[model samples]
Target chain A: MAEYEQHDHDHIEHDHMTIPKYIGIFLVLVVGTILTYFAATVDLDFIFPGANTLVALLIAFTKMTCVMLFFMHVYWSPRMIWLSAVASFFWLAIMFSYTMQDYLTRDPGVFSP
Target chain B: MSSHSETGKFHYHEPGLQHQFEDMGQQEESVSIGMWMFLVQEIMFFGGLFTAYLVFRSKYPMAFAAGSNHLDAFWGGLNTLVLIVSSLTMALTVYYAQKSNRNMQVIMILLTMAFGATFLGVKTIEYRDKFNHGLVPVQGWNKRIKAETNAEHETKPCWEVDHNAPAIEHPNPRGEFQWTDCSLVKKAQDEGYLTNAEKIGYFSNGEIDANKFRDKVRIFYYLYFVMTGLHALHMIVGLALMTWLLIVAWRGSFSEDYYMPVEMSGLYWHFVDIVWIFLFPLLYLLGRHFMHGG
Candidate 1:
């Protein structure tokens, strides 16, 4: 194990996230949650239809980014790790878009007898 | 290398390091990548359900709105907060593990488990509330009240109340899924904005049928139960993970040189938190504005 220690001192990288940083992220997440909760109370369809859903989703996306980057440590991970992490979302997008394309493009009248 | 093998040790040996790996860094990398791949698959697993939700919600938005309107956002929001705090504790557990602070590691793991239990506890309360209100989608699964003493209260839909607010009860005779509010469907019909799916789904012979609308709302609750039930199942697994982590951490098994287990489990805990982050807004918050005179 001594050789392992040598490599650790020489090659291994540690992110060493500070307590304050974690606390900051936690506070940000809490605020985001609160914002999402209250945002649903206001009828923002006057501004634009589905504005509330868009805003909530936007906030959720932001919060998810923070968790994945900082909490999950993708921010400090290697390039390949970043690639794999991002690839999941990329594949998810494809799944969502392709499925939505099929559902959204169907002629409604075609189903009617 | 032969001599080292005879001595039951290798030149690159580290605690928990497998013989196949040349060094700890290689092992850590391989394990980390493996965990990420597993999580990616998990995302896709839940993604299918999400797509189903999107499709159905887009088709029968009024039914979704009415169903979502009844979910106590207060309980859902509180659970979100509980989960976030647990994630913080989990992250701290990883930090302490890397610091080789055994006591702190044990404490943090315990705290994480505590918060996880709190989340599950809150879910139990919400599920029980659903049972009392006959919100469980499956027939004969909810609390059954055969009497008609609840006739006056039948028409009254419960307002979404904040934390610690007393739960209002609804009576169901046959212990079936019940959705009394059809106001949103009526509004859509009156506004002439009903989608094609809704035009057929909610209407019976040119009139809005309450039972037909209830079926659509049942779809919403079905998705709700499946998604959140799977999430809760994950939390249960997470708690089981913490149990293992706690035992090892208490034995002082992890240290600065070998804390990969802690880190990997932290990834899992945080991933669950991320899922809840999305689930909260989608399941509880999205359709809320419809309740406010929309």
Candidate 2:
């Protein structure tokens, strides 16, 4: 039991995120924000309709991932904790998918005429 | 070291360890799981709003685009940056707490609180702008003007891009929500992507109706207010959490053995930031391409 306690301490110490790493992720997030802002200014509809929205969402998703992993320290968390985090997102995706499926497949003709 | 209670059973006494938990590791894991569960529910709470936005936006793309175009991206972007920086400070506070560096912990907490306040300050400016422009959806909730006789209070054309069209008075006599631009409807007419909802929603006698279009735009502004208002409320709660953290850190109450409070609070702060990360683009950036004629 004493050895088990020491092992747990050493395991957590190994997982500690460095201060520099935190700052690095911060810089990445700031750059991602600026990039998304400028990306919105340029007309990307030439690529495809709603292309601009897609690009902006992609950038935002990237920034969110950085925050969740580094700033929130989920990267250093144990397996169960990380699984729960991912599971939350999975559940969110399920909600979005089901809701969107209903809306996207609806016949607008029913609402009008 | 293990001690004995009166009954002679083993009692492991780690600092900050609850009696229910077998060890510090177990205690930390349990608390973290609990916090994550709370955040999961929070995501769903906000997720419902996002679903509403998606449905309406898809139904009336032009209206959503026009309404989104009016939002000041500069202010939204500034708030996004502010929240991101605050998350950094919050993460640093947790870092310093783990190192037993009380002074740095206090300083970082103060910095986090300052940034959180700055974000809320920016929200106040944005909300006030919405009120002044008669963009609030509720009746009698906007800035009311009694008369337009004053030279400085002359009514101006309500263009979608009027934020840059010089200072002009928006006279709202009955404090009703005001929106006059229907250019997106015209554009959609030309492009032929206007949905049947928009067909019935924005037209009267085969002609585009400004009032009908305005009502659709009103939906966009309504979601904008509710989402950002709730986000700002969360930031206020984060500030309160930081204030408590400041007092405890100043008292040097945390060390390597006990910094879970700081970590948990940091988790919450970053979660709030993540929400704004998605909100800024969805609200302010998505429809900007429409204005650029993309």
Candidate 3:
């Protein structure tokens, strides 16, 4: 078999991210942080017990989306890369939820004692 | 160095190949997969603490809310912004490295390290303030210092006036009455929560009275220290990695095809920033809800 030679393409056909896209992601992250802080200050007791947690999780998910899509270059990469990351998250959710079921159901005072 | 134009396919099986890998792509894939696995483990590590926080808060909602109010949101917000900026710089560093721009890569990495350091510095200031104000959890954990000070000053007795003088005098210039050191411990000793032998040992060793000062609230401080300390350690490790990368980058060791190390390190740095994004709100902002009466 012949050795494969590296080819130099002056015009690389890969999709490149623009500076504006990066700036847009950064702006969204900033807005998300501010909104999270604002949400924390709100009196949402009437809404639910963990309203703040829910709002925070939503903001965190948004931020994660921005980071994964833009900073990690996942959007520019092959479909396989994106699939792997999503798979990892899926596994993580399974692990977290399974353990949390047992944890949430335990005697509340067990640890305190 | 062989030019890519001279070869049809990039020769990645050079001397840098680790013993475990058959080829470059496979090695790269395995390394990335392994890193992802480690990151998953890290998630679980932090997840356990988060679950604990949730359980305790649910059990003692009032105490947790009260604890939350004491956290200053301004610092948390500023730190979030700082970490985001660091993430941007880190991403830029990877971008520049991919383009084989050595100077830009070095500059971006340095900027990222600077931001990480700034974050740790701010965190140090916040932790120190908490320590000095006795806001740390132990046993007899002092409540919010500002609120307590206001309350104490509002009811302080006038020293120069007669007993019949007005009950509420001018705000005490000295502010809240400082609790006498170890007095609570002495009270605890009198109450039999602590044996006389333990009291003697505490007094002799200058150990704080456990019974009087037993603020289980200290548990919060313990969590604060563990989480923030672990985060800070990650930042430190990132800074060190960047510093090493800076030296190599300055020496012009990387090119378009061989910038994988820098790219991988950037991924790690960005992950750290992501952790801080979650931590800032959970640790600092969550408590701000108490400021408005429920």
Candidate 4:
């Protein structure tokens, strides 16, 4: 595999997001943020025990995807760019998995708990 | 870096190209790819802290929740809103930069910088408040200061103040707890929700054991400072980059043909925004409702 791409970046149509579309995404992001704030203060745990972290993380992930796909122009990007974006998360997962192996399974009281 | 001038194909050569690439499109893609690579490393850097935060927060849910609540959600939430708006302007700046619209591009970049400054401003206020209360994670930081300060709002609790103009709570044993539900525990005890032994274990002299909470609270501040401090540092870097871009844009540097700087900087700015999107919930919103009892 080549380190650099061969495709003409200029020849390719750069489907830049329209101003209105960017505004719409911004509105959604704002609303999603407010919702994330409120949802944290609600007892989602009552609905399903220990789901607050899950709900919070899920919302965060959604917001992250929006930013990446639209704000970062990932949605209009080519395969290499998309793969690069996914690669970052993949690397993050590696860090999380190995680290959590020790953290989640370790003795909780080791930290003066 | 190789001399990009001599080795290029029959190309739309721009002023910024090094002696390394085939053409402008390839050069721009290379720049974008390089930025993403840097961003990947950035994710790892922050990932280390997030992992530590997760480990500790899980180990000390009560302390973490209580510590998280000490932070003013209004400021954190307002900063989130501010950053998102900044991101919109940033994306617009890049868009106009690609169109070579100098006025809109400069305006949007300025707006983005203003928003970024606003975020740091709000952060400075929060940091000052924490410092005033001695919430610094290192030496001279009073680990108990937050709980101590929050204890003064015993009747209304700290959050009730946030619902209003959010008057500052003082240091007093009775005014304890920022989460609304700690007051509930007090209420439950008052109305006799617990058995005598439970009351004895959970409370002593009609108050929760604030001493038992010291270490966890300290850990919370450690995570808070490491994460948010690093974030603020990134904002500072972004602001510096924006200042550079603003100066160059003022000199009629970027155009539809050569706007790599604007695009790359926008990516950096958006990456910071995305990190905050995750950070806000993890740091500010984690366990907010469920840990209300904390």
The lDDT leader among the candidates is: 1
- DockQ scores for all predicted structures: 0.57, 0.59, 0.26, 0.46
CAPRI docking class of candidate 3: acceptable
Best by DockQ: 2
Query: Which residue pairs clash in candidate 1?
Result: none
Task: List, in the given order, the native-contact fraction of each candidate.
Answer: 0.66, 0.63, 0.35, 0.67
lDDT of 2: 0.84
Task: Provide the lDDT at A66 for model 1.
Answer: 91
> lDDT: which is higher, 2 or 4?
2
Q: Write the per-residue lDDT of candidate 2 for residues A1-113, one digit (tens) a residue.
A: 34434524632442367888888999999999999999988888789888988998899889988998888878878888788888888888888889878877777566432
Q: For candidate 3 chain B, which ten residues in a row score worst on lDDT?
A: B154-163
RMSD of each: 3.9, 3.2, 9.9, 6.4
Deviation in angstroms for B175 in model 2? 0.9
Error of 4 at B95 (Å): 0.6
- Candidate 2: which stretches are off by over 4 Å? A1-15, A109-113, B1-12, B149-164, B292-294
lDDT of 4 by residue, B1-294 (tens): 223445435444455656566566677778888888898889888888988887766555656666777788899999999999999999998888778789998899899999999999999999887866656656555324334432433564322223334545444233222223244334344555443323443454766654434544668888898899999999999999999999988877787767778888988998899889888888887757844444
Clashing pairs in 4: B3-B19, B4-B18, B4-B19, B4-B20, B5-B19, B151-B175, B151-B176, B152-B175, B153-B175, B154-B175
lDDT of 3 by residue, B1-294 (tens): 222232324443443345555545555566666666666677667767766666544443433443455567788789999999988888888778778889998899889989988998999888766655555554333323333454543222111223244433323232321221233234334544443333443343555533322232345556666777888898999989989999999987776656667867877787788888888877777756644222
lDDT, candidate 3, residue A90? 76
Whichever of 2 and 3 has more lDDT, that candidate is 2
Q: Which ten residues in a row have the lowest lDDT in candidate 2 chain B?
A: B1-10
